[model samples]
Target: MPTEYSLPDTLDRIYTNQLALEAAIMELTLLIEQQGHTEVGENVRGALYAIGENAGHIKQGIAKLVLQHRGD
Candidate 1:
């Protein structure tokens, strides 16, 4: 029997989202660094934090892929 095809599309969507989030986080970091401590400083700091948390998740996903491919 043929396997379902939905999973690859879903994986691609997720990977794209992760890339977009990473790019947005990079931009936000730049903006915050340029603005320094000001009225928007707190908000920017929160964004930076959220980015770090998201990055941790991305790293885990990548690690799992590596392990799976390596047959570990």
Candidate 2:
């Protein structure tokens, strides 16, 4: 069982993490664009793309949580 503060606290943490992840994705996008490369190579670009996708999902999930909890 969780306390009253626990659910919101956990959601808050998730939101915070999503914000950071989105920022990281934006940074990667900038880097890739600045480099003007078609790909990130065999490992690096692949990892970045995967991270960006996951971050997007996290952001979406957090947004849903906010809507459910805060009526946004």
What TM-score would each prediction reach against the true structure? 0.44, 0.46
Candidate 1 residue-wise lDDT, 1-72, digit = tens: 222334443454676786687678668767866777454756766776787687767667766765664563
TM-score of 2: 0.46
Worst 10 residues of 2 by lDDT: 1-10
Each candidate: what lDDT?
Answer: 0.63, 0.64
Candidate 2 stretches greater than 4 Å from native: 1-5, 38-72
1-72: candidate 2 lDDT, tens digit per residue? 343355555866866775687577667766776787545533555665677677767767756765776642
Error of 1 at 20 (Å): 14
lDDT, candidate 2, at 21 = 74
Candidate 1 regions with alpha-carbon error over 4 angstroms: 1-37
